[model samples]
Target: MTYCKVCSLSGEHPGIVLDEQQVCNVCRLDSVGDLLVNYRYTQEVFEKFQRAGRTEGAPYDCLFMYSGGKDSTYMLDKFVTEYGKRVLAWTFDVPFESEHAAENIRLAKERIAATFVVDADDDGIKKMMREVFNRPAPRKPGNYLDEKLPCVSCRTFFVIRAILHAYRHRIPYIALCADPQQILTMESDVRRIVRGFYEAFGVALADDLFRGELEQLLFAHDDELPQIVFPFIAMRHEYDPDLIVAELKAKGLYASSPMETHCTLFPLLNYYSFTHWDCMFYKLNASSHARAVKRNGADGARSTFSLKFPRSLNVLEVEERLRTVTLRIAKGEGAAEEHEAALIDAFRELGTSEEAGRFIARSFLEMPAVAADMGIRLT
Candidate 1:
């Protein structure tokens, strides 16, 4: 794979344009300046939040979207311990949540604040995934995978849910646990993609997939949405996964080692996008990712647990994960075995036929004309 010499991003990343010198466009565009600019803005936002303290004895000051992961739990700790803010923790219980995550949730509540676990509409989510995956590819400049990523659907659900929870509770700011790269991606095209989802598939089906109230929340204007907060992003923090896990373990609030298990569909998405677009979603944030690496360097910099953030993980680990998934797809082992089991259950429970899975997997295995158009030819 060809990589940008300066930023170390490769051709497999989305939004990566290489110059004659082999430096990625991110490097060419001066990503360091972008990172600093984002940092300043987010810092201002966070300070404004600090000034607007909660009313004394209010049920909560802010609603935190907690996933029982280290980044989120760290935010929970920071809010309760550092800032002394009354936080209400929210967890969307995706169907594939591990038992370890449940334990982490229990510990989180014990250590910090009251937690509310909202069970995701598993059947509905599955149906949407089925719809997104099974549909014929849309004619677009980049890969449909760029827009059709399941993470968009999942994250949008929580964003809307957090907004609704905030509205009901009178919480002004909804704190997110995303890092700089995640903050960039999370802010990208979420509301637009969701709006398109509803517009494409009638509101009646949307209402069927999501609750009536949530459907309304999804369609709300961008400005009308809750004020979202990114604490780590505001501070420009780059934390080691080891330190985060250690901190939680010391508090006896975490039960498992840090693992980078993304959504089951993510591997499939990565495989197809890399094969076709020669650029994946993670690459979209490469510029900001490169900034973090340059500022901290390899010794001090932590990986963002993304392929685009090559400096975050050791070269071997990154290559192994990428190659492993590629090999799996090449062998017709589409999703991970665990995910295959979950997908089977999802299809059955959601009343989606097996053909939906077949269609998505088949789409992943093919090299579309778009790749050839982009001059990404494979043997």
Candidate 2:
């Protein structure tokens, strides 16, 4: 668990390289000076995107992925109020959506006059999610499991679905509030994982015909991919969560705080926190960096780290929140319980027994004893 001197990254990070100074490659690639320049450069890119997107008689300027979270809410605000873009806000709802998030979506619809779309494949998605979290990570030659990151799988699905939607609708750009870490891995890493999955299991399931079909389905031409745009990355300002909260409140569109929906798979990730990939996405949120720093000082032995600097939050407050969440999860009182209840309800909704859910989940974990008894086949 050696941490980078510059950023909040650690030695266990994927493809991480350390120099004589022990700074991570990502930290070296990004510096305070370079960041200042990038801020201006990104602003130029945003303006250029805006200009190119301003076509006459276009139905919508950009397809925005709105999660009703603070980051995305700010993105929606800037797109509408600052740039005055005609946005089509799309939300991919899973079975674990929070009531508060739905409320925020409702308010966003009223506030922006934006076309709202929810891609909720509850039954299908529940099965997929179950598979993702329950299945164990793939094993290497040494019998060590790789990072079975459900977050990566989840985001990849969102990107593919968003791309297809934008392509069908002739949307020019697909906008998201993704941070630097997500931008680095979402496309390349996810595609690699998909190819690996097919390579490993496709041959067992199909002959040449199915293989050809799979190849065509996966290896789409460059033109078929959607144009991605990130407003938060472009606008290089340290986000103040409290300030954003105030803005949302003033507009009368603020719902409850983020992470209101407890994901059933999240507990599995926490248990695998050695990789620090469990809640990596959430940890990279706007203010989480500052929060983590405030709670655990730079020298403290904290498992998670943030890649941002110049914190705007009060250290004590952020530390308290983080501690509370950690304790609640450990005690099975707050989000953990919420996730458990949601998982059970989802099983009932799908007309499946709890044991059936467990059976389905075991297939993901690669537990041979249970999988064999259930007569499950991976290929």
Q: Best-fitting candidate, measured by lDDT?
A: 1
* Cα deviation of 135, candidate 2, in Å: 3.4
With a 3 Å backbone cut-off (N, CA, C), the pairs that clash in candidate 2 are 135-364, 135-365, 136-364, 136-365
RMSD of candidate 2 to true structure, Å: 10.1
Q: Number of backbone collisions per candidate, in order?
A: 1, 4
For every candidate structure, what is the RMSD over all alpha carbons to the true structure, in angstroms? 9.6, 10.1
Lowest-lDDT window of 10 residues in candidate 1? 370-379
Per-model C-alpha lDDT, please? 0.58, 0.52
> Residue by residue across 130-169, what tens digits does model 2's lDDT show?
5554456534321111343555556655565666677667
Question: What TM-score should be assigned to candidate 2?
Answer: 0.60
> Each model's TM-score, in the order given?
0.69, 0.60
Model 1 residue 333 lDDT score: 63
Q: What digit string (tens of lDDT, one per residue) describes model 1 on residues 223-324?
A: 455577777777655645567767888988777533322333444455445444544434444444555677678666544542233354333233334544
